[model samples]
Target: MRYYYAEHQAAYRRLGREGMTQWNDLFGESWTFDDFPNRVFLESVLDRLPASGEVLEYGCGTGPAACFLAARGFRVDAIDLIPEAITLARRFAQERGVTVNFSVQDVCAMPVGSKQYDVILDSYCLQSIVTDPDRAAVLAAVRDRLKPNGHYVLSTAMYDSDRVYEDDFRYDATTGICYERSTEPADDAVQLDNTWYLPHRRHLRPKALRAELEANGLQVLSQQGELRGDVICTPTRRG
Candidate 1:
């Protein structure tokens, strides 16, 4: 697990340096790997949040959503594990004329001091942290940083009902890790080849995801979508 976490960190650092630019060039600036339903759902709900509040965005890639929150009157602090990503996010925030505290920090081991947030947003990055314990640590950190009435927004891919492995990818049942080897090879930031590989992707079952959240003291208040699930959670009362 430690080795995989190290690998994950290294992969994202490389991706932050190269993959992000390649993605913007290949897919254009608006090229986000988001499903329309989830994206729409998130924007609609987030936009309706109180005009002013403290917000924390975990795994904020290049700062679009974080900027959006900051622009919407929230005191925003966004963190990403990759230093290059933080650099890009800071530049993007500056370009957008919005203020965001963007920092290079690990989600599992957040570096926040006594500060807490009223809202925490997780957009598809929770599943990227492959190992169960690591994911649990992140959830616990979120619990610790959130205000009593604070909410956590999570969006993630759902496991296919049939559990059929796509030609290019395979899900390991034992480790709950999904690995990919692309057949249509091309020069890309995340090289999906025999030797080079992309980061681990986890497609979680809705029941399992909810259970884990509950175990971490988060209670699911609502959820939306099928192919991709967007859930809102609130911290549960502790004895």
Candidate 2:
């Protein structure tokens, strides 16, 4: 199994079993109401959205963003690869008193069955897709499921130019891949220099990342931040 898939499922399984509601527990960040809505980039995204329309949130974990949009009267459809995450997402929507269509499916392989959304969101999911093919597939899915004038909103961790990689984590600037060193090797981990390294998130320079989005048919309209960037884009139209 892919490392991210397994890791994501494990997180959700723990959340569901522990009765925990928050999904943004990674990196010591708690995605609560106090922080999530007030995020600068997130606020920008909210400002760009239509007053009311059909929306899809790709890789929605526990339905925070989906429920947030739905509570304000936007019809929301969200999907995640983990069934556990979807179950908890349904509960989260209920707790928020909002109705959201939550499905358990990989965004890379989701069937775009005649439903084009006005807006599609990728909430911190793109960086997790490190492989070229999977990243392209997910972007293609976003393009295929979007209306002609639909917007694609994304939040991702960017390569911090000021930070230096050391200790357990190091970055390969050439491939734009980050590796987490571990004592034990995962089935998918790479063994180099007698150390087991797991393929972690991809943190591309903003310019390079934008080029990728464009290559995959998304034309970025605007972006913000350096270490963490939030982008809004639309599908590119070809002659």
Candidate 3:
């Protein structure tokens, strides 16, 4: 892992730490009020999820979505790379009186288990695997973890617009990595006491994402793209 990723992973391990606290202070309440509205990319996934079943959430940061599903009577298992995130999620579940299992594990190296979930939710996490070398393995691991006929819900931001900005932006269609320079000032301002800089954003194009999913065992059911408009895609498992 690079220095940034290592630091991020370490910060994640201590959820109640200053770093996570600041992050939650910045965006926690927004998710707490309504997960569906804020998670625009996951709208399709939310729509396709079964009302009551075992649901696994990848990168389930802070567990708002898992809590939302649990409140609605679904059994949820939420996982994230950051331990601190998982700890906070667990606390959130306890506070809400919901039973949700939050685990701190890397998506790329998900532990083996006999059980498979009915639905798997991946909201804007895969896109964060910015480097080319890691994308294939991450996708494959997700596929292997899913049950046959299971549903994999995924949402990613696609950059295809007429609007232009005066910042450094780079997009690689082959690797599906999008890097954008940040314009935030260096004040070290704390959002929940987390002083991390938000520099680049990465995601896959619609076509590339579909291809990767299909190459694994997942088949596209319906897909929608949201820029100024909503383009949703929902895919079912193949055999």
* Model 3 spans > 4 angstroms off: 2-33, 36-48, 160-169, 179-201, 228-239
Model 1 per-residue lDDT tens digits across residues 108-191: 777557888889988667777766677878998999888888989887766776767776666766445676664444332144
Clashing pairs in 2: none
TM-score of each: 0.76, 0.88, 0.71
Q: What lDDT is reached at residue 84 by model 2?
A: 91
Q: Which ten residues in a row have the lowest lDDT in candidate 1?
A: 185-194
Q: Please give, for residues 1-239, the per-residue lDDT of candidate 2 as tens digits.
A: 77678779889888877767756664457567425632566566676778788999988888887887888788989999999988988887887688999999887677657889999987788888887777888988888888988999888878888877878887889878888886797766888788899877898888888889899898899877655368888989967
Ranking by lDDT: 2, 1, 3
lDDT of 3: 0.61
Better of 1 and 2 by lDDT: 2
* Model 3 deviation from native, Cα RMSD in Å: 7.5
What pairs collide in candidate 1? none
Top of the candidates by TM-score: 2
Candidate 3, run of 10 with poorest lDDT = 187-196
| Whole-model Cα lDDT of every candidate shown, in order | 0.71, 0.81, 0.61
* Model 3 lDDT, residue 4, Cα: 27
Tens-digit lDDT string for candidate 3 (96-206): 899998887787666667777777776556656654445666666666766666777666555565535344555545554454443443332112123233324455566
